[model samples]
Target: MASKDLAMGMTFLTQTVTGILANVVLLFHYFSLCFTGYRLRPTDLIAEHLTIANTVIMLSKGVSQTVQAFGVKYFSQITRCTVLLYVYRVARGVSVSTTCLLSVFQTVKISPMSSRWKQLKAKLPKHIGLSVFLCWSLNMLVNCIFPFYSINKYSSKNTTKIKYFRYCSSGFPDKITEALYAAFVLFPEVSCSGIMIWSSSSMIFILHRHKQQVQHIRRTNVSHKSSPESRATQSVLVLVCSFVCFYTLSSCFYASVVNFSIPSWWLLNTSALISTCFPAVSPFVLMSCNSTASRLWFKFSGFVRRR
Candidate 1:
């Protein structure tokens, strides 16, 4: 293999393996907590779902990209291409929706406990499972059209209106069909993203206001340690900011690939790299930010040291 191909394969392989392992660890942590009869918070449930989606994203996209980077054709059949791409798209959409849900849930969780807020907060936990189910259902329905248009890469030669996706190809439909597809795909994602941004901004404002209140009450310049809520808010903010940054960049790269008649290998690789960044990094971010996870990690490290 060329040095460039080898490097790309290694990079993707590293990302895929790291992300899968991290996600698996996170999942195990959650399951262990549950099995120990520990009550999981609503956010924990959402985070568990998000971790599952991230694992799917890594397996479907990251692993395939790594294989393709090594000059191996993984999606050799149309069915394989369609199924993998569809699953990846659905998982990605679920990740976005779940993140948005997490942000909104946190916003409600930390809001001032007015009567209205209290009512909504009380109901939110009850609905988390339903909300997640809806996310999966909606995305599955929205992206179902992809299978009909998907074709094997080798079959691209027979068609002029196909968009090449390295190992697979998708037939470009008529303008109207394309426009409708775009609207279907973009609407839910855009809406979820907007909600996430709004919730994040509300969280920032609330945190700032709370800080001001604390400072005024203390009437001193000395810094005080943050509460659990504050730390969690900060972590969620970091998470949302990272997701938005990586998602925007990935979208741009994806658009560029689609716009070109024949996207360069490097462009495709770059897009794939950008797409996997959030999945690869998010589990570590969650682990570091979570107090329980931190404590568990410290204990594990201490045990290993003693051994």
Candidate 2:
């Protein structure tokens, strides 16, 4: 028992340290998100939405990580755990919604002239933001039903402490409800991915044709070269790739959880980590792909002109 307790303590400590680091990096990324519109363009709400999504995710992760790092032996009040779970739910909903919106944004940005995907290119962010707000409100209502229900105090002192973290859950209200909800959520996600892939593929095709034409007209003084635009396109591609993998894995894992393939306790400790990983991964991917970020530091320091 003592050895098992020590192992849990070590795991919590390691996880917490990493979680804190993720949040720190996310903070810098959040600034980039803000720069997306406020400095870049306030009307450019996609960057704002992405930043908001990442912020919520990291904060949710911090809440879970801090509590667990208190060590397994430290007992927490019902309010604390309830708060943690709620934070996780909100963060996750924002992350998924924001990512979905971003994927559609990419498709719109790169769609061929004749593609129907271009039609939604303009409305992507607004629709996504509205959808995010809607989903958030729904999640809050659903989660509240559980946390406030049957949240009973135990012990002579009325401790109201979770022996193993109780009061509200990640569990669905019922098996049928969980399955139906999973299908509903999963459908849009799969459809979005498909559309993104098709749109990106068409864009790549167009780019290739343009490249060939430019090569043929190289000495005619009419050829155009891709400069920063190519870099921007590649950066968007990287973001798309990141989500493809992250979303695929996360969706599969959630399906397993809903289907009862994963044990409940394991899901409890580990699921929160996935929230940190998704938004945390995207900004870094964007930084690596974006030449714009390279000029950001120098611009801020007055050492170089803003690109």
Winning candidate number (lDDT)? 1
RMSD of each: 2.8, 7.0
Per-candidate TM-scores read 0.91, 0.63
lDDT of model number 1: 0.84
lDDT by residue for model 1 (1-307), tens: 9999999899999889878877877888999999999988888989898999999999898888888888887465654578878999999999999999999999999998863578998898999989999988988988888787777655655445777666766765476776687777877877887888899999999898888778875666465678888888888888898898999899889889989768998898999899999988888778877867766656665775699
Worst 10 residues of 1 by lDDT: 151-160
Pull out the clashing pairs in model 2: 37-41
Off by over 4 Å in 2: 1-44, 69-81, 112-174, 184-195, 198-203, 217-226, 257-272, 289-307
Per-candidate clash tally: 0, 1
Q: Which segments of candidate 1 are over 4 A away from where they belong?
A: 153-160, 219-223, 295-307
Q: Can you write out model 2's per-residue Cα lDDT over 1-307, one digit (the tens) per residue? A: 3664456446655554544444455445546666666443211345445555565655555444545544532425554556655565555555555555555565466565677766666666456556656656765664554343224333323222222333232434455755575565456558667765765575577568757766756767664556555555666667767767777776666555545523465564455445356676665554554445434533443642333
Q: Candidate 1, clashing residue pairs?
A: none
